[model samples]
Target: MRRLGTFLLGVMLLAGPAFAAPLAVLVEERARSDYADSLPPEGAFEITVKEPPKGEVLTLAEFWMDPRSGKFLANAVLETGDVQRIGGLALITLPVPVPTRRLLPDEIIMEDDLTVMRLPVGRVGAYVETEIEEVIGKQVRRVLTPGRPIQAQSIIHPLVISRGDRVEISFSDGLLALRSPGRALSDAHEGQEVRIVNLISNKTVTGIATGAGTVEIVQ
Candidate 1:
């Protein structure tokens, strides 16, 4: 391997001048705005030169580019007849999840409820969860259908205490404890505040949800 590498280096040194040519490849600025699912059109690039290579032909190849960022990949090809040069650019994409079926209001989301999709970096919204783990097991906040992107506002933590259920109300300050039965006026998950109507007195009060069908009085 060492002898073959030395021999190749010598050949390259001898032929260095023959391949020494000056060339410039520039992607037009509009490419940044024109990127999408399709490759950037040929008109999105411009090549400039002062003089033609000495008895050499310039060959410029089409480039594969990301549609979202209008940036090309390292596969770009540039060749100069008398002066040789090459340049490359790389772009990144984002992986996002979309609902595979209709999610109704009050329904809980599950792992099989969504599908992963690849989107151009800029097309992804900041409030959207990029992975399924962040979305699955959450309760749907409203109606969403197939192909709709999942947003942070579209879901919520599974409710430990849902609305209208009979729950045990407890009041405590660490030293003393009191317990009573109450009716929840609204839905609340663990650690969330909710309204309850004391069953005996019929008085409304707000309390923190502590467990399934349980609430702790704030005062």
Candidate 2:
């Protein structure tokens, strides 16, 4: 009788995995559904069921989780219609903006140049840009590799005035206004300061780049 009982226990242990597999899928799906609203479109949760409930669970009736700790509790209905509680932990990933191809400095980021990638929340850093909109229309300040998170300082507004370009320099003190042709000594974006050499006076001065090939001297 002792040997027979031991054989029966071994059979139940062998059958445990078959029951656990289906329950694991259900649990993972429930966790994803519970946090759908907070998740990005391309984001998902990687669930690890620490303990599969010890019962013949037919279906999950309800589920919920703590967003902070990633601890989840589910109310499952057993085959016998009995309600059982199951708990586990999960690791969630979020979408981050990345370049679709290798981008070089001075290249402007277009909609097609950017895409989203899923990364573990802990791996994303504060220096990275999270949204595609944040990168679009911005010019690359440094080389960006494909599928890598873009650093915040890796891009800037497209330069409106390039070095050595002829620009119209304007000076105004409310009462007096004068405009002159000058050459840009440095590349500058809109509203950024640039050094300009006056074509007529043969003198160098600093001014703010107001538009394409245009600089406004304030001082």
Candidate 3:
């Protein structure tokens, strides 16, 4: 009896979590004005869900949980119509189709059999909300949510260049040139910061000449 009780306790501990279902949620359809006076046709608008598991449903509350948190943090009202008949079982999936007209700023639109509900959006399991707000009308607004955050280490532009600076080019041989606004100079003055553009390879190189007509190509 003692061994049986210990075995039963262990099975209960392991099975408890398996019986708890994850909170169901869906991402509401989002819509934005294109800055035109006339509204685009209803069918012309669409919202794309980003990040997370690609096929996971987008729901108001689920969108708020920071994925890094590793906790399912949101919930939603599921519609019977959105439920699918799979092998005689109802299965819920990501991106249950809702109409485009229901999305608002910080809100997600969901559909039922009779009407659509626009509810405040929330984060999903372990995910944090990173939505941006934009004004659409005198009193209307919209939210722009990015799929992922931009990393600080990603290079977007050249870091070492500045405007109105000299660029130099050196040839494999002892030839040099200076490139400036609207002109190129082959005979550059010594110790002058010069700019050079390679005509063959179409690359720009820069350096200060050590002497007059003595520019040597750096291998």
lDDT tens string, model 1, 104-137?
A: 9778888788898766555567787777888888
lDDT by residue for model 3 over 42-66, one digit each (tens)? 2222222222322222122222322
**lDDT of model number 2:** 0.81
Q: On a 0 to 100 scale, what is the lDDT of residue 14 in model 3?
A: 72
Please report, in order, the local distance difference test score of every candidate based on alpha carbons.
0.65, 0.81, 0.29
TM-score of 1: 0.59
TM per prediction: 0.59, 0.62, 0.17
Best by the lDDT measure: 2
Question: Which residue runs of candidate 1 sit more than 4 Å off their true CA positions?
Answer: 1-92
Model 2 over residues 1-219: C-alpha lDDT tens digits? 234334444554576732433776787677677677876565667766666656666556667888766788877665444566778876678889898999999999999998888887766788989888889999999999999999999999999999999999999999999999999999999999999999999999999999999999996
- Give the best candidate by TM-score: 2
Judge candidate 2 at residue 134 and give its lDDT.
Answer: 83
